[model samples]
Target chain A: MKNKSIELMKRYRFFAIMIVVTLAILVVKPDMGVRVYSLAFNSVFEMLGVLPPIFILIGLLDVWVKKETMVKYMGKDSGIIGVLLGFFLGSAAAGPLYGAFPVAGVFLNKGSRLANVFIIVGAWASMKIPLLLFEVAAMGWQFTLIRLVMDIFGVLVIAYSMEKILNDDDERQIYELARKMSQ
Target chain B: MIMTIIFYGLAVIGLVFSFVKSREKTKMALMKALKAFENILPQFLGIVLLIGVILSILSPQQISQLIGENSGWVGVVIATVIGSITLIPGFLAFPLAAALLENGAGYMQIGAFVSSLMMVGIVTMPVEVLYFGKKATLLRNGMGLVFSILVAMVIGGIMS
Candidate 1:
């Protein structure tokens, strides 16, 4: 029981510290504290709304997608098909960038090519289609279209370069981490 | 939003199909998801709270002043730095960028801010490091920061 409680504390240390900090702020500056809570709560509410289905999809992918299938579609030799799929998957998603990490873990666990996973993340970060529409509306079609074109190129460049920079050992370590996390 | 509807629709369809195919596998999938979410909950809470604190402190008026018209490359640098640190959702970010632009913030600086806001996340680095390790996280964000500058330059040249 004691050990379990200790483990829980370790897991929650950062959260606990932040809570205390928030409380201290509340004491010192009630207005600021109220703003903090409202903003934080809003975000938490939004996250709660979005994350469940994403996690479910991730879980399904982990359980259903065979390693061979993932490798064939997204592994090192999957080529342009893999890249397009990565881009599509990333662009189609709805959620924040952090939500992409666990899904990326599933991809890694399924033996996806490093570059493809990187593309997925890059797309998730900046190239999301729905967000692009929003961008276009706000910034004008010219700005949005140009940025979109450049960003596709940017995503590819970042993905491939990052893949090249990672040595075999580093790749292995990341793969291992993914494998452990999903299990 | 339409995106949320699409996500839920897809998830429901996928879940139904999985259930039909194999109840056991569906169960396993849900369990794995719950475990993954539980594992990250603590870090997620911390990150969100940090974002709230940062955003509350950096009010919209302050942002407009920092990146106002004629603020130039210095404003771009400041905007990019602010973007990198703050974790604004893309939906809110675009509208806010519009509001900033209307309030006299330069397009170049807004470009830098939007690009960095999407790509580079300093506050969420802890969650990223959990998945990609320390070195990769730093390298990716570093490269992202550089790329955001390029994006700003391109937008500036074209729009100006």
Candidate 2:
């Protein structure tokens, strides 16, 4: 029990330090400290609201989707269909880029192609539909359109290159990490 | 708001269907998810606090000053670095970027900021490395940094 508690504290050391820093800021700079609390509260609220369903969906995907089925759609030899699906699913997502990582973990656990997974991450990062609408409204359609075209090209380049750069051992290690995370 | 509802609705519907098909499997899935989430909760808590502190330190006014009209390519580099380090939500980021743009920040700088803000994540590297490992996470962010620069240049050329 003592060892487990110590391990937990080690894992949470960063959070503890942040709390201490925040308290110091409260003493030294009250206004900035309040801002930190409010921002942190809002983020925590958002995370609580958003993460449960996402985790449930990931869990369901893991349980219901067979490895063979996943491989058929998103693994090696899945081809253009896999790429298109990755893009579509990512663009349709409704959460922050961080949220994509856990989902991506589940995908990797299920034997997704490396490039396809990277494409999903790229699309989630740069090309979500709601985010695009916001960009167009705030930055003008011309600016949004130009960035969109460029970002699509960048995503493709980055995804393919990331996949190609990984040797078999590196790829295996990543897969092992994903398996551990997803479990 | 609506997105949250949609996600919950989807989850509920999927859960119901899964339960109807097989109660045992549904239970197993829920257990798996809870375990996975528990494993990462500590890191997520740290990330939230880190972001809160960083954003408080680097207020919008401070950011605007660094990347305002005369800051040029130097501003783009600084903006990208700030964006990578910070972890603002999309809802907040767009408005923040808009505010900076209106406050005399250059198109190139704002472009770099927004692109890098979304594509690169130095703060969330621990979470990413959990699944992708250190090497892949670093490579992706390195590539993302390069791409964000390209994005800034293209936006600067066409928009400005």
Candidate 3:
């Protein structure tokens, strides 16, 4: 029991330290500290609102989507279809970029091409469909359209470049890492 | 709002379908989801706190001042740096960007900020490194930073 508690503490060490820092800020700067509290509250609320469904979807994908099916669509020779699927899956996703990492890890674990996984990450980061609507509303269609076009190309270029730059050994290690993470 | 509803709607539909297919598998999926959520809880808490600190320190007025129209390429660099470091959600970030634009921040600077805010994540690097390893994480974020700058330049050229 004691060992388990210690391990849990070790896992949460970063969070513990941050709490201390936030408390110190509250003590030293009351006004800013109040702002921090409210902001943190809002962030937590947002996170809660977005994360549950995302994780549920991920869990469903993991359970229902067979490895062979994933591989068939997104694996080594899946090619442009894989790329398009990556983009579609990513754009359709809701929540922050961090949420995409676990999904990408699952993709890699299921034998997705490295470039395809990168495409998912890239699209999730910059090309989320829902966020695009928000961007259009706030930044106008001209700015939104221009950035969207550029991002489509940018995501593709970055995905392919990252795949090309990593050697075979690095690729093996990444796949190994993903396997560990998903498990 | 609509997005949130869509997400929940899809998840609920998926859960119902999965449950009808196999209660055991549905239970297993929920367990896996809980486990994954718990696994990342510590990092998520830390990120939330960090964002609180950063956002509190950098108000919209202050951000706009740093990246105003007259701030030039220097503003773009600052915006990129800030964007790379901070991890604001899209909902908050877009309105903030819009407000900054209204406050005389340049299109280029806003573009840099928005792009990097989405793509490059210095604050979330720890979480990223766990999944991607150190080298891949660094390379991905580095590429994202470069791409964000390119995005800014093009937006600046065309929009302004």
Model 2 bad stretches (over 4 Å) = A1-3
lDDT of 3 by residue, B1-160 (tens): 6777888899999999999999999999998788778777888898889889998998888999999998998999999999998878898899999999999999999999999999999888777876788888899999999999999999999988
Candidate 1 interface RMSD after superposing interface residues: 1.0
Listed in order, each prediction's TM-score against the native is 0.97, 0.96, 0.96
DockQ of 1: 0.78
Q: lDDT per residue, candidate 3, A1-183, as tens digits? A: 999999899879988988999999999999999999899998888877778998888788889999999999999989889999999998988888998888888899888999999999999999999999999999999999998999999999999998999999889998998777666
RMSD of 2: 1.4
Better of 1 and 2 by DockQ: 1
lDDT by residue for model 1 over B1-160, one digit each (tens)? 7777777788899999999999999999999999999878899999888988999999888999999979998999999999999988888999899999999999899989999998899998888887888877887898899999999989988887
lDDT of residue B40 for candidate 1? 84
* TM-score winner: 1
- Give the per-residue lDDT of model 2 (tens digit) for A125-170: 9898888888888888887898789888888899999999989999
Q: List the residue pairs that clash in candidate 3.
A: none
Ranking by DockQ: 1, 2, 3
